[model samples]
Target: MDVKEGDVLNYDIVVVGGGPAGSTAARFAAKEGADVLVLEKRQEIGSPVRCAEGVSLSWLEELEIDNIDSSTSRTMKGAILYSPAGNKLKITERLAGDEVGVVLERDRFDKDMARLAVKEGADFMVKTSAVGLIKEDGVVKGVEARYLGKKFEVRADLVIGADGFESQVGRWAGIYDSLKPKDIMTCFQYRLTGVNMDPDFTHFYMGSSAPGGYVWAFPKDENTANVGLGLQFSRLKGEKTPKDYLDEFIENHDDYKDGEAVDMVAGAVAVTHPPEKAIAPGIILVGDASRVVDSMTGGGIVNSLKQGKIAGEFAAEAVREGKFDEEFLQKYEKRWRDELENKLWRNYMAKETAMQLDDITFDKIIDALSNIELETVTIGAILEGVKKKYPELVEEFQNMI
Candidate 1:
């Protein structure tokens, strides 16, 4: 099974991208007896990381991922959400497991995930970019790719597209891959040291500074944090970019003003309505490539990782049964949707409603939420409380609850 340069290789399953989702899919598929191979466009598995590196502990536990301590930076207990006028609403882990997740050493986390996939008998190729699909009679058969400037073909019975938000695989397969500007969040983040803040809580600022989105301050350690902001591109009314807003925010905040900036990153996150289909004959999309990110939270690592496991398991099953058509691959869509699509859709609608709220409405929400115990809070309960004070607004959100 050695893959030499300029030689055509074959695998039972070929996963494009070596991110968490790709690695997870490769691992599970290989474990189920498929000859799997992963192609990462980058020279290294996890270089130039583009994430905030935060994830929920409960889901990680559910995934049964081991050796997590190697990549864990800090464990959070809860979150503190601030209104436009700065009113605070605190929520503990008891009510929100994701709010109390851990900050990760993202590079290490990715590398470890890929390593695990290799241990499960999956082959990996870095500096390998999948340029196009290998199709026969209108069905995907594999990928046309390049490695270290040499082009080659990889034939596989199944293809898993974990190539991220701007997924070429999804596009090449004739699936709808374009996202409206309103559905995309332009973000800028700075990893800073010497910032003094509580390491146990993640801070969120909701207001016009980042219209239709929020600013986040996630602690990596006691004196270091990832300070960033994400704003819906459609709501960007003027010339100022997310970077400008973030700089202004840091200047106004006492704790972050003097912090030493260690690194900076910029990217766009797809928060659009989920596609009607993430699968086609002989292929399936996973992770950001599938746009599984929660619109409200702008987070997808957990969902993406979970879907990777689902897709991998199903791919192996399909290969074993000699079924690789859309009808069979559709089951992969069904299983993941059953597990996460409902919640993702709900959150997307909720985010739409929240984005339209005025500053006053947010303040009212914070006030109402303050009156309730965090442990007893749910979407319905919070909306019910809001009804007592703002019936019209609550009515509009009733469907969301």
Candidate 2:
């Protein structure tokens, strides 16, 4: 539906898609005094969350962003790593980053952020889907969308697209929206309600069993955890899906065979770093919408919060200064990319090399790693071991190294 002139829907910064990225962006923008509005494509804002629910508290602090709520967390003590041969090694949550992250009730957490955003004076339209951008003089000037089948247009001085992976905003803004099949990770998780877990450390199982990917059991409520699996699409070429792998995993494992099944969640994540360009003439993209997820660990909440805040702050500041071009918006890219992109670059490189290892090689590598202290087990550490022990293998990734 075309938007008529003088439409009532308008905003200083219209934020499309109110997930963590959108909410945080809206909250910060409104907190900074922008007339912000967030449109979520669902009825219940955070319901049916499609995330792994793990986030680094340490990283959270660095962003200095508030959790949408305090009531919806399942604090975990740490994480565990399992080799292809079924050998398990655990690191206290403290070890990963020292008091690092927590498993959140994602739905509640989302609503909380929405509450904060609303309290700060941001409007919300649930069941809204952004369809296209309205351009003027070759610049993004507004968004046209559908809310409960009713067409509406929102004009904004700045439009922040936090719509996550599969975002039309990026395509509308002229970004190449295609993520290489290898660049994305397909994930499947189940919120098992009657299962027994370590109750402390998250468990990650790796090797050919989950080629190009791994399996995880992240702590949630007692007797509950987000048990899931993720694998590169290439891995799925001749194998079962992540969900199927997860089922086989649980069924074969003696301790998990009888666990009652409850909620199941599934989604795809951009395991790549943020795209080369995240902002355009009159808009900026954040969170999964910009592929801000970490390729190394598949973690994104902290990164999303950080990116969203920057987009929010810049949007408001840009509005105030009347600058909305690439020159002004590029700050969003430089800030996030400079601080975090290089790490992702390294991760992407390491991931490609790591996935090629067979179970025996995985065992050898892990056994070698066992000799090194966890504190020193950086990507460089692993690469060095591969170089010293498997010189030929390192040769394959020498360019990346």
Candidate 3:
């Protein structure tokens, strides 16, 4: 429906933001016969691309995304990790963590996700922004939204906040806190053409070159790749930015120095552990709004899709049971946490521990791992290998083991 000024709309569930999380929530909820609506602030479902477009394929079957291959740009076999001192460690795609496996054409991927929701009977309005929450005696009841230049109200039995990192929907409901500097990664990226590199493996460079974060090159094609880096907010100096570091790295690399940048993107990612609470009466926060991005890799696609499915199904159940209270919503909270909390917490701690390592220690750790033939790659297994070669280096990571 076209929303005009003074329009008052209603739905069983309203999802704010139309990225993977919001779309997934809408798709699942509408599939269950809920009257669902999604409002995206941007003029299109996905534009002004802000991601490196890397994702792990292992979760696709679980997410039930049937046409993922149409949006995939390249398939990665594994990833090569380079330490500051030039030590290299290669890990297979299955063990390379969540960010490696396939590179996506994110704009197309996001649109495809939203299309799935619409196909399931979810109504979506692009250029619609949720400006505030509507509350009834301290419980969220709906949202005050602006569509194009017209303002309106959308009342719903439940509201899902799937807004991105700087989400305001969760804050308006008083369930989200601002991220600390140490927990934020300011990022920048470029799609470069004519890059000479292996297309089969994703590349990562660690150390002082990208303090507290790392540099990545995810191939989009045989000659094009997304070259990017994230700089930990706390480690950033007044003048040097993520772009500066990225530019230096590219200039120093023989393969990338001659490449031409055809596209550029900049954004911030929350690298904190998931929030203690993401639920309030009639409202649930998912994706970056709830800080569910992996603290170690700054990846959120898989986690967002998982949380969205959980929230959508629960929202549908809430409408059927006539239960929109906080107590009723606790089930959604518990299920998502049970599915993701342990790994998120572990990754958060690992990121914290990694930030303390110097170049020498990083090299020692990577070099040690490179020398071993591990049948399985895991935190405990990697630590065990490092412990055999350099016992002192594994001390700090003992807790993670």
Question: Per-residue lDDT of 22-121 in model 1, one digit per residue for the tens?
Answer: 9999989988999999999998887888888777776766665864889898888888888888898888878785546888888899999898888889
| Cα-lDDT of candidate 2 | 0.77
Q: Report, for all candidates in order, the number of backbone clashes.
A: 0, 6, 0
Residue-level error in angstroms, candidate 3, position 339: 0.2
Candidate lDDT (C-alpha), each:
0.87, 0.77, 0.89
Instruction: Write down the worst ten-residue block by lDDT for model 1.
Output: 370-379
- Tens digits of per-residue lDDT for model 2, 1-401: 23344455768999989988899899888888999988888888888888888876765555455542484467667777788776666666445665456788888888877887888888998887878888888888878888766777898878898888888788888775577778778888877766777777677888865677888888776677788888887667655678788888888765556677688888888786457788888988888888878787888777788777777787888888988888988877787787778877887777767767788877766666665556544566566766766676667667664
Worst 10 residues of 3 by lDDT: 92-101
TM-score of 1: 0.96
Write the number of the candidate with greater TM-score, choosing between 2 and 3.
3
CA error at residue 12 for candidate 1, angstroms: 0.5
Which pairs, if any, clash in model 3? Answer: none
Candidate with best lDDT: 3
* Pairs of residues at least 3 apart in sequence or in different chains that clash in candidate 2: 57-100, 68-113, 77-93, 78-93, 94-98, 164-289
Predicted structure 1: clash tally: 0
Question: Once superposed on the true structure, which residue ranges of model 3 sit more than 4 Å away at CA?
Answer: 93-100
Judged by lDDT against the true structure, how good is candidate 1? 0.87
Error of 3 at 354 (Å): 0.7
